[model samples]
Target: MNYTQNEKIKQVDEKTLVVGVDIAKETHYARTFDNRGIEYGKVIKFNSTREGFESFEKQIKEIAEIIGREKIIIGIELTGHYWYTLANYVNKKEMMLVQVNPYHVKRAKELECTK
Candidate 1:
């Protein structure tokens, strides 16, 4: 199902911990932000492996604990076919995963630069 821009924005709230990820072939980068887009921690680079995924989960749990948020929404752009494995892993963990459109990401970046 496709959600409108407003609908997507409504999914996140004060209790939501939003994570924006830049997925790559081997390593993926992620940063945690609040519902209002305030970043909470430094960027983390985790490899595409079981251990790496565990580490990423650990980091997310730690952040959630610190911020007192149980809901996590992970957003990632579909970079070729690299997201399937990670997406499956994330699904197994029961965390909410969202696929971001690359065009929207590009537009968001451009909008940010104008600010």
Candidate 2:
């Protein structure tokens, strides 16, 4: 099965900043949200590497400035033993890491659909 990078982020618009990422062996999908939870941009593909870190740094800086906050919260579905690298990167900065259950995300989607 094949999946597009943008398919990972659901219900994006221009509100409270949120990013949905699908962790993969090679690359990941990223979607962004604004202060009001509205997505106002494109979903781009990001790889896990040195250059990837550079790009992520630039984006994170922009996000921090937008919200006037030094810290950001990043959530990823816990993939047991494989996402340590990504977790480390977030932990090294003035940011927080959240573990989300895929089940919960699905439930939320269901609720949103009913709304």
Candidate 3:
């Protein structure tokens, strides 16, 4: 299932909620965004433990309900082994998880800052 950039972009629509997470060894930070890149809530800081994942899931569900979006796509930077736990948790929860390139994320941040 290979997707071109355009196809990948098309996957997000008005009914979709995108979650971008910055994974760390112990804690993770997440933000919710709409298909047009508008943020919906504050940054969520959750630990890497199961309790933390549960908290994260709760927040995501609340946000989605508030925003009236049913589809969730969680994206995380593909770092070290720290992301494995989160990936598995997201999979078990039956949500779509996207692994992003760390370098690409860094470069995008740099470009954003220069704007």
**Can you give the TM-score per candidate against the true fold?**
0.92, 0.66, 0.95
Error of 2 at 73 (Å): 1.5
Winner of 1 and 2 under lDDT: 1
lDDT of each: 0.92, 0.63, 0.95
Which wins on TM-score, candidate 2 or candidate 3?
A: 3
lDDT of 2 by residue, 17-99 (tens): 56666677768666665546565356657777767756776785686577554445566777656567777877776555667
Worst 10 residues of 2 by lDDT: 7-16
Candidate 1 lDDT over residue span 13-55, tens digit each = 9889999989999999999999888998899889999998999
Q: List the residue pairs that clash in candidate 3.
A: none
lDDT (Cα, 0-100) at 106 in candidate 2: 85
**Candidate 1 vs candidate 3, TM-score winner:** 3
Rank list by TM-score: 3, 1, 2
lDDT of 3 by residue, 12-98 (tens): 999999999999999999999999999999999999999999999999999999999989999999878899999999999999999
Top-TM-score candidate index: 3
Whole-model lDDT, model 1:
0.92
Query: Local error of candidate 1 at 94, Å?
Result: 0.7
Using lDDT as the measure, name the better of candidate 2 and candidate 3. 3
